[model samples]
Target chain A: MTAPDPRLSINQATIKYAPLAEALHLTAGAGITSIGLWRDSVEAASLPEAARLLAGSGLRFSSLCRGGFFTVPEGPARRVAMDDNRRAIEETAQLAAAGAPGSAAVLVMVAGGIPQGSRDLVGARSMVEDALAELAPEAQAAGVRLALEPLHPMYASDRAVISTLGQALDLAAPFAPAVVGVVVDTFHVWWDPELTKQIARAGQEDRIASYQVCDWQTPLPADVLLARHYPGDGVIDFAAITADVQEAGYRGDIEVEIFNQEIWDTPPGTAIARTIEGFGSAVSPHLLQAGARR
Target chain B: MTAPDPRLSINQATIKYAPLAEALHLTAGAGITSIGLWRDSVEAASLPEAARLLAGSGLRFSSLCRGGFFTVPEGPARRVAMDDNRRAIEETAQLAAAGAPGSAAVLVMVAGGIPQGSRDLVGARSMVEDALAELAPEAQAAGVRLALEPLHPMYASDRAVISTLGQALDLAAPFAPAVVGVVVDTFHVWWDPELTKQIARAGQEDRIASYQVCDWQTPLPADVLLARHYPGDGVIDFAAITADVQEAGYRGDIEVEIFNQEIWDTPPGTAIARTIEGFGSAVSPHLLQAGARR
Candidate 1:
């Protein structure tokens, strides 16, 4: 039998309960060739050790989990966020250097939510644009692309002001596609009505940075932030969306990033196995269709 | 002392704890000229008696709370929803007849959530369009317009598939403005980046059916559906949104409709008072600004 698609990636956060090195080892052991790493876990294992582990595992880094929260209002706070982001970009460059050729070298950017005590959403978004303009040079210099991720509209208040793929692409329009791009995560964007047009637009603009997949479940856990489910467990049309993204010319890792507690509680190896099983059913056909579309 | 700006209305669902008669009495006593009625309370008191109560109290019906759940796929279920909407239109006509001239006589339509066991959001939205086409003539004959309300995207999966003001306006495009229009509720739309443009579009199209206001709160309650807060209690930019809506030429009632446990737990009188105070602080200035812009 053919091995599980090498391009199928498991974002470490999907099994966040697993320690970074263990998640990486388990992903490689499961024959998956790619994994998206989170900075928190990378920082927790010391970057040098994390680098050593990745080099040994042969797992490609399909984009770093994140590095953008530029919504703070105070000058000092703003500087601190930028400083952290710059460091994140440097780390992303290092991860990319360690990965095999053609692996995703993108650094995902989740624009932070509204500033404290501020009702100015437009103002807050402007801050993100200003922040991105400031960071573009640093990202380009570091050889890391900034992938602006548009979280679901539900998170517009406290998680991200960027709530739609079109808005994200628009924000990225000012920068070079290599310096700035957008992340299309099904969990956050599946409900968007303008998704089809936006995905195509992202393709035409050559700004599709990372394509993440996870299903959206409702009654969204009390801490809705962590409520994402495995694909096929919820109502998303994975086949259509994957096909659309592929049609958009995103020839990159299909990263599964489920954030549910139950999945995290499972044994790491079991979780990865289940993730692969879900991915095979939910995404494979779309990849073939996307090839046909081209 | 200026009598709650005659156009500032109260949707009965905002103070759902109050009985139909008592809520009306309180609204009229408060000097608020309009109140949007809900079917449950109207039915509880009997529609005819409700009509008498409205006529006697000198309060106008800004709009009936709602009537549309066309997302149900079953043949019997679809017929039931259509029949219910027809009755709702009839009720809207009766309420309009009871109110003083110039009062709102629109039926608010919340396109229902996705059907049980179906992940077809596009199909569900199409069902709403078909339902609206069938109901438009009925609404026209009754002299009560159908106001399609685009609920927040968070409600897309379960409460309303129509998740944008633009989509709502698009659905209402085929019908006459007097037969079908769009409702802009702040709680559901404040996060939309396309809001200002959509509000202007709705106005240009003469599709502004009702303008409702409620603030969006976070760490949303376990029952996220009822997590909305009173104006000024959350993160929405009421001034900008209200100003934009007013700028769009919607010379209609600004109905306050919050769904929250804490607000409901408060005494109805206190809740109404708080809502009015919140509205004055959060929304009134925008109305004045809109007038100034004109």
Candidate 2:
């Protein structure tokens, strides 16, 4: 059997407690080949310095954390949001230009939620489509594939109106390959019934921008803002989902993006080590050993 | 516009704090047209006494609480579990037979969860199918239309492996309409991406057995056993969901099924009254308006 690819990518949020340079160095030292950095982290350390650190560490950019909150409702505020997204696209392009070769890495898109005082989720979804249409040309020029992340339904009201992998696909369908795609986060969509079908659809459409892993806790807390489950801590069927993604022909970085207070409080290195271990124990066994191969 | 139907149905668990006969009397006095009694409640009250209370109160039977634990793995224990489900089906038949003409109701089925020490969710699902096949014929003879309740995926481990309406439909698809159908409960499936599609499918397939309502909390607790949101308390796009159900031709009692510690602590009368109010403000506006226009 061929050796398993050791391209473990660390999401900046996993070590959000650490400074960007420190986190990058930590990830590199751990021998992880790739890293997914947030724009905020890049902003905190000057982009040039952050780029220098990546260059020194020899870490390939898996993806730029995000660049799409285009679901703002029509009005002055919407224009402002669009302007902000354009700036984000420019920054993503700059990062892409500075990073390793190939098509510019994915610019993860998180469709923003319903505007204040609006109950129209469908309307918000349309707003995202319109914004993506507006931003498509610029994104294409930058050579960055926009990865639309469908947040969990719990965040549908205030985070991302695009709340399903299928819904994200519908939004991205109208755009060209480089202009629009999707980010599949396990934390958000581990419970979806059409998960396998949607992932297959994503692969067929060539819209597999990123694949993330996390768990879904039961007895979810009353507050939605703080609700998130660590990768192996909750009850998501990760093994089956990963297998489906692979079957769909997606050979991208299986990014581990966890949003947990408990994990976040720990030291960045410790968290990364724990996450790496969790990924191996929870996912690798299933992905690596299928049928009677074991 | 037509007046909305007000046939209140008391799920035995609603007044679990009270004795079964007392609950029946209280619900009857509240002018409810129907009542749902759990097997445990009936057993605790003595089946004959429970039967007498139902007869005396002139309450209609909306449904027998449940009958399905086929996911228990193969063994002596599995046989015992199946036997228990069969007995539950027999009791439901007895309840239906004892009811007045046009008053007999369906038997709600909570498909069992993954068997102990088993991680094979799909295998557990097959067990449910086998159990349903065995029980369907008996249920048909008893005049009980088995209403398979698709529980939340969070309960896939220990409560019910049938976690989506679509999955439930697939399970019920092979059975005769009278032998098997579906109960769409908002609490369990509010987060489903294909909810509208599945509800439409259920309607098209003529498999809708009951319509139930509840809300989903955000920070889902870590514990699986004690997490539920009351109607109108959480951020589910309920109006849109029920509208789809209505368009799909599901016309039934929009039962209020809340499993919350706060609500449970309140007096049954207060809880029922609150449920009625919440149901009206949160759900009825959408459902009743649709009914009115019809």
- Fnat per candidate: 0.53, 0.19
- Give the TM-score (0 to 1) of chain B in model 2: 0.91
In angstroms, give how far residue B131 of model 2 lies from its true place: 2.1
Residue-level lDDT tens digits of model 2 in B66-185:
787777767898788778877777777777656555454588888876666555667778888888888888788777788999887556656887878988999898998777999988
State the lDDT at A126 in candidate 1. Answer: 94
Q: What is the TM-score of chain A alone in each candidate?
A: 0.96, 0.91
Q: How big a share of the true inter-chain contacts is recovered in candidate 1? A: 0.53
Instruction: Count clashing residue pairs per candidate.
Output: 0, 8
lDDT of 1 by residue, B87-161 (tens): 899899998889866677799998988887778888888898889888888888889999999988877888899
Off by over 4 Å in 1: A1-3, A289-293, B1-3, B289-293
Residue pairs that clash (backbone atoms under 3 angstroms), model 2: A219-B220, A219-B221, A220-B219, A220-B220, A220-B221, A221-B219, A221-B220, A221-B221
Top candidate on TM-score is: 1
Candidate 1 is scored at a TM of 0.97
Least accurate 10 contiguous residues by lDDT in model 2 chain A: A285-294
Fraction of native contacts, model 2: 0.19
